[model samples]
Target: MTALRTGVTALAVLLAIVLQAALLPHVGWRGVVPNLCLLVVVAGALTRGAHFGVVLGFCAGLALDLAPPADHLAGRWALALMAVGLVAGLVRRDERPTIPVVLVTAAVASFVGASVFGLLGVVTGDPGVAVTDVLLAVVAGVAGDLIVAPLVLLPLMVLLTRFEPQRRLA
Candidate 1:
Protein backbone atom coordinates (compact mmCIF):
# COMPACT_ATOMS: atom_id res chain seq x y z
CA MET A 1 0.00 0.00 0.00
CA THR A 2 2.84 2.40 0.77
CA ALA A 3 4.38 1.49 -2.55
CA LEU A 4 1.11 2.21 -4.29
CA ARG A 5 0.84 5.54 -2.52
CA THR A 6 4.39 6.46 -3.50
CA GLY A 7 3.73 5.47 -7.08
CA VAL A 8 0.58 7.56 -7.22
CA THR A 9 2.34 10.54 -5.68
CA ALA A 10 5.18 10.21 -8.17
CA LEU A 11 2.75 9.98 -11.07
CA ALA A 12 0.89 13.02 -9.86
CA VAL A 13 4.15 14.96 -9.53
CA LEU A 14 5.16 13.96 -13.06
CA LEU A 15 1.85 15.08 -14.49
CA ALA A 16 2.10 18.33 -12.58
CA ILE A 17 5.63 18.86 -13.93
CA VAL A 18 4.50 18.26 -17.48
CA LEU A 19 1.63 20.66 -17.09
CA GLN A 20 3.87 23.23 -15.45
CA ALA A 21 6.56 23.02 -18.11
CA ALA A 22 4.22 22.76 -21.08
CA LEU A 23 1.14 24.74 -20.15
CA LEU A 24 1.61 27.08 -17.18
CA PRO A 25 4.43 29.05 -18.82
CA HIS A 26 1.91 30.34 -21.32
CA VAL A 27 -0.44 31.38 -18.52
CA GLY A 28 1.50 34.26 -17.07
CA TRP A 29 0.73 37.69 -15.74
CA ARG A 30 3.20 40.41 -16.69
CA GLY A 31 5.80 37.81 -17.59
CA VAL A 32 5.50 36.09 -14.24
CA VAL A 33 4.81 32.39 -14.56
CA PRO A 34 3.36 30.18 -11.83
CA ASN A 35 5.51 27.54 -10.22
CA LEU A 36 3.06 24.69 -10.08
CA CYS A 37 5.84 22.17 -9.72
CA LEU A 38 7.07 23.94 -6.60
CA LEU A 39 3.58 23.86 -5.12
CA VAL A 40 3.26 20.15 -5.77
CA VAL A 41 6.63 19.47 -4.22
CA VAL A 42 5.67 21.40 -1.10
CA ALA A 43 2.32 19.63 -0.90
CA GLY A 44 3.98 16.26 -1.18
CA ALA A 45 6.48 17.13 1.52
CA LEU A 46 3.72 18.36 3.80
CA THR A 47 1.66 15.21 3.28
CA ARG A 48 4.55 12.82 3.43
CA GLY A 49 7.87 13.30 5.27
CA ALA A 50 11.49 14.29 4.83
CA HIS A 51 12.60 11.01 3.25
CA PHE A 52 9.85 10.99 0.70
CA GLY A 53 10.21 14.68 0.14
CA VAL A 54 13.93 14.46 -0.60
CA VAL A 55 13.41 11.63 -3.06
CA LEU A 56 10.56 13.37 -4.83
CA GLY A 57 12.39 16.66 -4.77
CA PHE A 58 15.37 15.15 -6.54
CA CYS A 59 13.13 13.77 -9.26
CA ALA A 60 11.27 17.03 -9.74
CA GLY A 61 14.52 18.98 -9.76
CA LEU A 62 15.98 16.57 -12.27
CA ALA A 63 13.02 17.18 -14.55
CA LEU A 64 13.41 20.92 -14.24
CA ASP A 65 17.15 20.67 -14.80
CA LEU A 66 16.64 18.73 -17.99
CA ALA A 67 14.02 21.14 -19.25
CA PRO A 68 14.65 23.31 -22.29
CA PRO A 69 16.21 26.77 -21.95
CA ALA A 70 18.23 25.34 -19.11
CA ASP A 71 21.15 27.45 -17.99
CA HIS A 72 22.50 26.22 -14.65
CA LEU A 73 24.34 23.06 -13.67
CA ALA A 74 22.29 19.86 -13.66
CA GLY A 75 22.65 19.16 -9.94
CA ARG A 76 21.97 22.70 -8.80
CA TRP A 77 18.20 22.29 -8.78
CA ALA A 78 18.49 18.88 -7.21
CA LEU A 79 20.36 20.40 -4.28
CA ALA A 80 18.08 23.39 -3.96
CA LEU A 81 14.89 21.35 -4.12
CA MET A 82 16.26 18.81 -1.73
CA ALA A 83 16.76 21.58 0.78
CA VAL A 84 13.25 22.92 0.14
CA GLY A 85 11.70 19.51 0.59
CA LEU A 86 13.63 18.80 3.74
CA VAL A 87 12.60 22.11 5.23
CA ALA A 88 8.93 21.70 4.31
CA GLY A 89 8.78 18.15 5.50
CA LEU A 90 10.40 19.00 8.79
CA VAL A 91 7.95 21.83 9.37
CA ARG A 92 4.75 19.99 8.50
CA ARG A 93 2.67 18.67 11.34
CA ASP A 94 -0.12 16.16 11.77
CA GLU A 95 -2.65 18.96 12.09
CA ARG A 96 -5.02 19.70 9.27
CA PRO A 97 -3.26 21.16 6.27
CA THR A 98 -4.65 24.53 5.24
CA ILE A 99 -4.52 26.62 2.08
CA PRO A 100 -2.46 29.35 3.69
CA VAL A 101 0.13 26.86 4.84
CA VAL A 102 0.39 25.29 1.44
CA LEU A 103 0.58 28.59 -0.36
CA VAL A 104 3.10 30.10 2.01
CA THR A 105 5.27 27.02 1.95
CA ALA A 106 5.19 26.87 -1.82
CA ALA A 107 6.02 30.54 -2.12
CA VAL A 108 8.95 30.26 0.25
CA ALA A 109 10.23 27.18 -1.49
CA SER A 110 9.99 28.93 -4.82
CA PHE A 111 12.06 31.78 -3.46
CA VAL A 112 14.68 29.46 -2.10
CA GLY A 113 14.81 27.44 -5.28
CA ALA A 114 15.19 30.57 -7.39
CA SER A 115 17.78 31.97 -5.06
CA VAL A 116 19.82 28.79 -5.25
CA PHE A 117 19.59 28.75 -9.01
CA GLY A 118 20.52 32.41 -9.18
CA LEU A 119 23.47 31.97 -6.87
CA LEU A 120 24.65 29.07 -8.93
CA GLY A 121 24.42 31.15 -12.06
CA VAL A 122 26.47 33.88 -10.43
CA VAL A 123 29.05 31.39 -9.26
CA THR A 124 29.24 29.89 -12.71
CA GLY A 125 29.82 33.38 -14.11
CA ASP A 126 26.58 33.75 -15.99
CA PRO A 127 26.67 37.42 -16.97
CA GLY A 128 23.09 37.69 -18.12
CA VAL A 129 21.58 37.91 -14.65
CA ALA A 130 22.63 40.60 -12.23
CA VAL A 131 22.19 40.40 -8.45
CA THR A 132 19.17 42.67 -8.63
CA ASP A 133 17.73 40.59 -11.40
CA VAL A 134 18.08 37.44 -9.31
CA LEU A 135 16.38 39.11 -6.37
CA LEU A 136 13.59 40.40 -8.59
CA ALA A 137 13.15 37.00 -10.17
CA VAL A 138 12.86 35.42 -6.75
CA VAL A 139 10.28 37.95 -5.70
CA ALA A 140 8.30 37.53 -8.89
CA GLY A 141 8.48 33.77 -8.70
CA VAL A 142 7.24 33.80 -5.11
CA ALA A 143 4.35 36.06 -5.98
CA GLY A 144 3.42 33.97 -8.95
CA ASP A 145 3.67 30.72 -7.00
CA LEU A 146 1.58 32.11 -4.14
CA ILE A 147 -1.08 33.29 -6.54
CA VAL A 148 -1.46 29.94 -8.29
CA ALA A 149 -0.58 27.64 -5.41
CA PRO A 150 -4.13 27.02 -4.32
CA LEU A 151 -5.21 26.09 -7.81
CA VAL A 152 -2.66 23.31 -7.86
CA LEU A 153 -2.94 22.41 -4.19
CA LEU A 154 -6.72 21.94 -4.16
CA PRO A 155 -6.75 19.47 -6.99
CA LEU A 156 -3.65 17.75 -5.65
CA MET A 157 -5.23 17.43 -2.22
CA VAL A 158 -8.34 15.99 -3.79
CA LEU A 159 -6.33 13.48 -5.77
CA LEU A 160 -4.28 12.53 -2.72
CA THR A 161 -7.40 12.11 -0.63
CA ARG A 162 -9.08 10.02 -3.26
CA PHE A 163 -6.13 7.85 -4.10
CA GLU A 164 -4.26 7.56 -0.81
CA PRO A 165 -6.46 5.93 1.77
CA GLN A 166 -4.00 6.90 4.46
CA ARG A 167 -4.44 10.57 3.67
CA ARG A 168 -8.21 10.17 3.66
CA LEU A 169 -8.07 8.58 7.07
CA ALA A 170 -5.75 11.28 8.34
Candidate 2:
Protein backbone atom coordinates (compact mmCIF):
# COMPACT_ATOMS: atom_id res chain seq x y z
CA MET A 1 0.00 0.00 0.00
CA THR A 2 2.78 2.44 0.84
CA ALA A 3 4.51 1.59 -2.39
CA LEU A 4 1.34 2.16 -4.38
CA ARG A 5 0.76 5.49 -2.70
CA THR A 6 4.34 6.56 -3.33
CA GLY A 7 4.04 5.60 -6.97
CA VAL A 8 0.81 7.51 -7.35
CA THR A 9 2.30 10.54 -5.67
CA ALA A 10 5.31 10.42 -7.95
CA LEU A 11 3.14 9.94 -11.00
CA ALA A 12 0.94 12.83 -10.04
CA VAL A 13 3.93 15.17 -9.66
CA LEU A 14 5.38 14.05 -12.95
CA LEU A 15 2.09 14.61 -14.75
CA ALA A 16 1.73 18.06 -13.20
CA ILE A 17 5.25 19.02 -14.24
CA VAL A 18 4.68 17.79 -17.78
CA LEU A 19 1.44 19.65 -18.07
CA GLN A 20 2.94 22.81 -16.60
CA ALA A 21 5.91 22.62 -18.91
CA ALA A 22 4.15 21.53 -22.10
CA LEU A 23 0.75 23.18 -22.01
CA LEU A 24 0.62 26.05 -19.56
CA PRO A 25 3.38 28.02 -21.24
CA HIS A 26 1.03 28.63 -24.12
CA VAL A 27 -2.19 29.09 -22.20
CA GLY A 28 -0.83 31.36 -19.49
CA TRP A 29 -2.45 34.71 -18.93
CA ARG A 30 -0.09 37.65 -19.35
CA GLY A 31 2.98 35.56 -18.67
CA VAL A 32 1.59 34.37 -15.36
CA VAL A 33 1.03 30.66 -15.53
CA PRO A 34 -1.00 28.55 -13.17
CA ASN A 35 1.29 26.40 -11.01
CA LEU A 36 0.08 22.83 -11.27
CA CYS A 37 3.04 21.47 -9.34
CA LEU A 38 2.32 23.78 -6.46
CA LEU A 39 -1.27 22.61 -6.47
CA VAL A 40 -0.09 19.01 -6.29
CA VAL A 41 2.04 19.84 -3.29
CA VAL A 42 -0.84 21.56 -1.61
CA ALA A 43 -3.01 18.53 -2.25
CA GLY A 44 -0.41 16.30 -0.69
CA ALA A 45 -0.04 18.58 2.30
CA LEU A 46 -3.77 18.73 2.83
CA THR A 47 -4.22 14.99 2.45
CA ARG A 48 -1.13 13.80 4.27
CA GLY A 49 0.81 16.11 6.60
CA ALA A 50 3.43 18.86 6.74
CA HIS A 51 6.40 16.50 6.47
CA PHE A 52 5.02 14.74 3.41
CA GLY A 53 4.08 18.02 1.81
CA VAL A 54 7.53 19.46 2.43
CA VAL A 55 9.25 16.44 0.89
CA LEU A 56 6.91 16.33 -2.08
CA GLY A 57 7.17 20.05 -2.61
CA PHE A 58 10.95 19.98 -2.54
CA CYS A 59 11.07 17.14 -5.05
CA ALA A 60 8.49 18.66 -7.35
CA GLY A 61 10.03 22.13 -7.15
CA LEU A 62 13.47 20.77 -7.83
CA ALA A 63 12.10 19.01 -10.89
CA LEU A 64 10.50 22.22 -12.06
CA ASP A 65 13.70 24.15 -11.47
CA LEU A 66 15.67 21.58 -13.43
CA ALA A 67 13.08 21.03 -16.11
CA PRO A 68 13.91 22.31 -19.57
CA PRO A 69 13.45 25.97 -20.39
CA ALA A 70 14.23 26.75 -16.80
CA ASP A 71 15.83 30.18 -16.54
CA HIS A 72 16.34 30.60 -12.82
CA LEU A 73 18.53 28.91 -10.25
CA ALA A 74 17.36 25.44 -9.15
CA GLY A 75 17.11 25.90 -5.41
CA ARG A 76 14.82 28.91 -5.80
CA TRP A 77 11.81 26.77 -6.55
CA ALA A 78 12.88 24.16 -4.04
CA LEU A 79 12.62 26.72 -1.29
CA ALA A 80 9.43 28.28 -2.62
CA LEU A 81 7.49 25.03 -2.88
CA MET A 82 8.76 23.89 0.47
CA ALA A 83 7.19 26.98 1.98
CA VAL A 84 3.97 26.31 0.08
CA GLY A 85 3.78 22.77 1.35
CA LEU A 86 4.43 23.86 4.92
CA VAL A 87 1.74 26.52 4.76
CA ALA A 88 -0.81 24.24 3.14
CA GLY A 89 -0.03 21.36 5.45
CA LEU A 90 -0.69 23.58 8.44
CA VAL A 91 -4.24 24.05 7.17
CA ARG A 92 -5.05 20.35 7.01
CA ARG A 93 -7.92 19.01 9.06
CA ASP A 94 -8.94 15.62 10.39
CA GLU A 95 -12.02 15.78 8.18
CA ARG A 96 -11.86 16.05 4.42
CA PRO A 97 -11.07 19.58 3.30
CA THR A 98 -13.94 21.49 1.78
CA ILE A 99 -13.96 23.53 -1.42
CA PRO A 100 -13.51 26.73 0.53
CA VAL A 101 -10.54 25.25 2.29
CA VAL A 102 -8.99 24.15 -0.97
CA LEU A 103 -9.53 27.54 -2.58
CA VAL A 104 -8.07 29.37 0.37
CA THR A 105 -5.12 27.07 0.51
CA ALA A 106 -4.52 27.46 -3.21
CA ALA A 107 -4.60 31.22 -2.92
CA VAL A 108 -2.23 31.29 0.01
CA ALA A 109 0.12 28.78 -1.53
CA SER A 110 0.20 30.66 -4.82
CA PHE A 111 1.02 33.92 -3.11
CA VAL A 112 3.67 32.47 -0.84
CA GLY A 113 5.30 30.38 -3.53
CA ALA A 114 5.50 33.18 -6.05
CA SER A 115 6.64 35.76 -3.56
CA VAL A 116 9.31 33.50 -2.15
CA PHE A 117 10.68 32.70 -5.57
CA GLY A 118 10.70 36.31 -6.58
CA LEU A 119 12.33 37.38 -3.35
CA LEU A 120 14.98 34.72 -3.70
CA GLY A 121 15.81 35.89 -7.18
CA VAL A 122 16.35 39.39 -5.90
CA VAL A 123 18.31 38.30 -2.87
CA THR A 124 20.50 36.00 -4.90
CA GLY A 125 21.16 38.67 -7.54
CA ASP A 126 19.58 36.46 -10.21
CA PRO A 127 18.44 39.48 -12.29
CA GLY A 128 15.36 37.43 -12.99
CA VAL A 129 12.49 39.82 -12.38
CA ALA A 130 11.46 43.20 -11.14
CA VAL A 131 9.53 43.68 -7.91
CA THR A 132 6.53 45.12 -9.71
CA ASP A 133 6.47 42.23 -12.10
CA VAL A 134 6.66 39.77 -9.25
CA LEU A 135 3.79 41.53 -7.52
CA LEU A 136 1.71 41.35 -10.67
CA ALA A 137 2.58 37.71 -11.18
CA VAL A 138 1.66 36.90 -7.62
CA VAL A 139 -1.78 38.42 -8.05
CA ALA A 140 -2.39 36.67 -11.31
CA GLY A 141 -1.03 33.40 -9.99
CA VAL A 142 -3.35 33.45 -6.99
CA ALA A 143 -6.35 34.11 -9.18
CA GLY A 144 -5.35 31.50 -11.71
CA ASP A 145 -4.65 28.91 -9.02
CA LEU A 146 -8.02 29.54 -7.41
CA ILE A 147 -9.76 29.03 -10.72
CA VAL A 148 -8.12 25.66 -11.28
CA ALA A 149 -8.06 24.46 -7.69
CA PRO A 150 -11.24 22.44 -8.05
CA LEU A 151 -10.13 20.62 -11.16
CA VAL A 152 -6.81 19.59 -9.65
CA LEU A 153 -7.69 19.29 -5.97
CA LEU A 154 -10.90 17.30 -6.36
CA PRO A 155 -9.41 14.49 -8.42
CA LEU A 156 -6.28 14.42 -6.26
CA MET A 157 -8.33 14.26 -3.09
CA VAL A 158 -10.18 11.26 -4.47
CA LEU A 159 -6.96 9.53 -5.38
CA LEU A 160 -5.34 10.24 -2.01
CA THR A 161 -8.42 9.02 -0.19
CA ARG A 162 -8.27 5.73 -2.06
CA PHE A 163 -4.74 5.12 -0.85
CA GLU A 164 -5.60 5.44 2.80
CA PRO A 165 -6.07 2.20 4.73
CA GLN A 166 -9.58 1.67 5.93
CA ARG A 167 -10.09 3.12 9.39
CA ARG A 168 -11.75 0.86 11.95
CA LEU A 169 -13.54 2.59 14.77
CA ALA A 170 -13.17 0.68 18.01
Candidate 3:
Protein backbone atom coordinates (compact mmCIF):
# COMPACT_ATOMS: atom_id res chain seq x y z
CA MET A 1 0.00 0.00 0.00
CA THR A 2 1.18 3.49 -0.77
CA ALA A 3 2.03 5.54 2.32
CA LEU A 4 0.00 8.41 0.98
CA ARG A 5 -3.04 6.22 0.47
CA THR A 6 -2.65 4.58 3.85
CA GLY A 7 -2.06 7.87 5.64
CA VAL A 8 -5.08 9.52 4.08
CA THR A 9 -7.31 6.59 4.84
CA ALA A 10 -5.99 6.40 8.39
CA LEU A 11 -6.61 10.06 9.03
CA ALA A 12 -10.12 9.77 7.68
CA VAL A 13 -10.83 6.66 9.67
CA LEU A 14 -9.56 8.27 12.86
CA LEU A 15 -11.76 11.29 12.31
CA ALA A 16 -14.71 9.03 11.56
CA ILE A 17 -14.16 6.90 14.63
CA VAL A 18 -13.94 10.00 16.79
CA LEU A 19 -17.10 11.39 15.25
CA GLN A 20 -18.93 8.13 15.68
CA ALA A 21 -17.79 7.72 19.25
CA ALA A 22 -18.09 11.27 20.51
CA LEU A 23 -20.56 13.27 18.47
CA LEU A 24 -22.81 10.78 16.70
CA PRO A 25 -24.18 9.22 19.82
CA HIS A 26 -26.00 12.49 20.46
CA VAL A 27 -27.12 12.80 16.83
CA GLY A 28 -28.86 9.48 16.62
CA TRP A 29 -32.41 8.83 15.61
CA ARG A 30 -33.98 6.76 18.37
CA GLY A 31 -30.60 5.38 19.43
CA VAL A 32 -28.92 4.16 16.25
CA VAL A 33 -25.63 5.82 15.46
CA PRO A 34 -24.22 5.65 11.95
CA ASN A 35 -21.06 3.68 11.44
CA LEU A 36 -18.95 6.44 9.98
CA CYS A 37 -15.86 4.27 9.91
CA LEU A 38 -17.64 1.96 7.52
CA LEU A 39 -17.58 4.68 4.92
CA VAL A 40 -13.80 4.76 5.02
CA VAL A 41 -13.64 1.09 4.24
CA VAL A 42 -16.27 1.38 1.56
CA ALA A 43 -14.49 4.29 -0.08
CA GLY A 44 -11.17 2.49 0.00
CA ALA A 45 -12.65 -0.69 -1.38
CA LEU A 46 -14.41 1.10 -4.18
CA THR A 47 -11.55 3.37 -5.11
CA ARG A 48 -8.58 1.18 -4.29
CA GLY A 49 -9.39 -2.56 -4.41
CA ALA A 50 -10.48 -5.59 -2.42
CA HIS A 51 -7.16 -6.17 -0.65
CA PHE A 52 -6.94 -2.60 0.50
CA GLY A 53 -10.52 -2.64 1.63
CA VAL A 54 -10.04 -5.81 3.63
CA VAL A 55 -6.97 -4.46 5.34
CA LEU A 56 -8.63 -1.15 6.12
CA GLY A 57 -11.69 -2.87 7.50
CA PHE A 58 -9.65 -5.13 9.71
CA CYS A 59 -7.40 -2.40 11.04
CA ALA A 60 -10.18 0.11 11.50
CA GLY A 61 -12.30 -2.43 13.29
CA LEU A 62 -9.44 -3.23 15.58
CA ALA A 63 -9.16 0.43 16.42
CA LEU A 64 -12.82 0.49 17.27
CA ASP A 65 -12.50 -2.67 19.28
CA LEU A 66 -9.76 -1.02 21.29
CA ALA A 67 -11.55 2.26 21.74
CA PRO A 68 -13.12 3.26 25.01
CA PRO A 69 -16.65 2.00 25.75
CA ALA A 70 -16.15 -1.00 23.48
CA ASP A 71 -17.20 -3.79 25.80
CA HIS A 72 -18.14 -6.41 23.25
CA LEU A 73 -15.93 -9.32 22.36
CA ALA A 74 -13.05 -8.19 20.18
CA GLY A 75 -12.76 -8.91 16.45
CA ARG A 76 -16.51 -9.03 15.86
CA TRP A 77 -16.49 -5.72 14.08
CA ALA A 78 -13.33 -6.72 12.25
CA LEU A 79 -14.97 -9.77 10.73
CA ALA A 80 -18.13 -7.91 9.80
CA LEU A 81 -16.35 -4.91 8.34
CA MET A 82 -13.92 -7.09 6.46
CA ALA A 83 -16.84 -8.86 4.86
CA VAL A 84 -18.43 -5.52 4.00
CA GLY A 85 -15.20 -4.32 2.41
CA LEU A 86 -14.84 -7.52 0.42
CA VAL A 87 -18.42 -7.43 -0.79
CA ALA A 88 -18.27 -3.74 -1.64
CA GLY A 89 -15.05 -4.31 -3.53
CA LEU A 90 -16.67 -7.09 -5.53
CA VAL A 91 -19.64 -4.91 -6.43
CA ARG A 92 -17.41 -1.96 -7.29
CA ARG A 93 -15.45 -4.12 -9.71
CA ASP A 94 -18.59 -4.86 -11.68
CA GLU A 95 -19.29 -1.22 -12.55
CA ARG A 96 -18.86 2.35 -11.49
CA PRO A 97 -21.62 2.76 -8.95
CA THR A 98 -24.28 5.37 -9.44
CA ILE A 99 -25.88 7.33 -6.59
CA PRO A 100 -28.54 4.69 -6.23
CA VAL A 101 -25.94 1.97 -6.17
CA VAL A 102 -23.99 3.83 -3.51
CA LEU A 103 -27.06 4.28 -1.37
CA VAL A 104 -28.06 0.67 -1.76
CA THR A 105 -24.55 -0.49 -0.99
CA ALA A 106 -24.46 1.65 2.14
CA ALA A 107 -27.78 0.32 3.34
CA VAL A 108 -26.92 -3.27 2.68
CA ALA A 109 -23.47 -2.96 4.18
CA SER A 110 -24.77 -1.24 7.31
CA PHE A 111 -27.49 -3.78 7.82
CA VAL A 112 -25.28 -6.77 7.18
CA GLY A 113 -22.45 -5.49 9.36
CA ALA A 114 -24.76 -4.76 12.27
CA SER A 115 -26.50 -8.08 11.86
CA VAL A 116 -23.20 -9.89 11.91
CA PHE A 117 -22.12 -8.05 15.04
CA GLY A 118 -25.36 -8.88 16.78
CA LEU A 119 -25.02 -12.48 15.69
CA LEU A 120 -21.52 -12.54 17.05
CA GLY A 121 -22.78 -11.24 20.36
CA VAL A 122 -25.36 -13.97 20.48
CA VAL A 123 -22.75 -16.58 19.76
CA THR A 124 -20.59 -15.10 22.44
CA GLY A 125 -23.42 -15.19 24.99
CA ASP A 126 -24.01 -11.51 25.45
CA PRO A 127 -27.39 -11.24 27.12
CA GLY A 128 -27.87 -7.64 26.11
CA VAL A 129 -27.63 -8.48 22.45
CA ALA A 130 -31.10 -9.61 21.54
CA VAL A 131 -31.39 -11.42 18.26
CA THR A 132 -34.72 -9.70 17.71
CA ASP A 133 -32.97 -6.37 17.99
CA VAL A 134 -31.02 -7.27 14.88
CA LEU A 135 -34.01 -6.53 12.70
CA LEU A 136 -34.65 -3.23 14.40
CA ALA A 137 -30.98 -2.38 14.16
CA VAL A 138 -31.03 -3.11 10.44
CA VAL A 139 -33.85 -0.64 9.99
CA ALA A 140 -32.48 2.09 12.22
CA GLY A 141 -28.92 1.56 11.14
CA VAL A 142 -29.73 1.95 7.44
CA ALA A 143 -31.42 5.26 8.06
CA GLY A 144 -28.42 6.50 10.01
CA ASP A 145 -26.04 5.24 7.37
CA LEU A 146 -28.05 6.87 4.58
CA ILE A 147 -27.96 10.18 6.38
CA VAL A 148 -24.18 10.24 6.60
CA ALA A 149 -23.22 8.46 3.39
CA PRO A 150 -23.64 11.33 0.93
CA LEU A 151 -21.83 13.68 3.27
CA VAL A 152 -18.91 11.34 3.81
CA LEU A 153 -18.62 9.58 0.45
CA LEU A 154 -17.83 12.40 -1.94
CA PRO A 155 -14.79 13.75 -0.13
CA LEU A 156 -13.58 10.26 0.73
CA MET A 157 -13.87 9.12 -2.86
CA VAL A 158 -12.05 12.18 -4.06
CA LEU A 159 -9.17 11.62 -1.67
CA LEU A 160 -8.97 7.95 -2.53
CA THR A 161 -9.05 8.74 -6.23
CA ARG A 162 -6.22 11.19 -5.74
CA PHE A 163 -4.19 8.34 -4.32
CA GLU A 164 -5.11 6.26 -7.36
CA PRO A 165 -5.20 8.66 -10.27
CA GLN A 166 -5.94 5.96 -12.78
CA ARG A 167 -9.20 5.07 -11.04
CA ARG A 168 -12.26 6.31 -12.86
CA LEU A 169 -14.75 8.05 -10.64
CA ALA A 170 -18.09 6.34 -10.34
Top of the candidates by lDDT: 2
**Model 3 misses residue 71 by how many Å?**
1.1
> Relative to the true structure, how large is the alpha-carbon lDDT of every model?
0.76, 0.88, 0.82
Better of 2 and 3 by TM-score: 2
Error of 1 at 32 (Å): 3.3
Clashes of each: 0, 0, 0
Give per-residue lDDT, candidate 3, residue 91: 72
For candidate 1, write residues 7-116 as lDDT tens digits: 88778767766777678777876666776666777777777767877887888888777777665678877777877788777775868668777767777788887798
Scored by TM-score, the top model is 2
Model 1 poorest ten-residue lDDT run: 161-170
lDDT tens digits by residue: candidate 3, 11-111: 99889988998999897987789999888888888777778878888898888887888877889989888887887777746666788887787777777
- Candidate 1 off by > 4 Å: 69-71, 92-94, 161-170
Ranking by TM-score: 2, 3, 1
TM-score of 3: 0.92
Q: Compute the lDDT of residue 142 as modeled in candidate 3.
A: 77
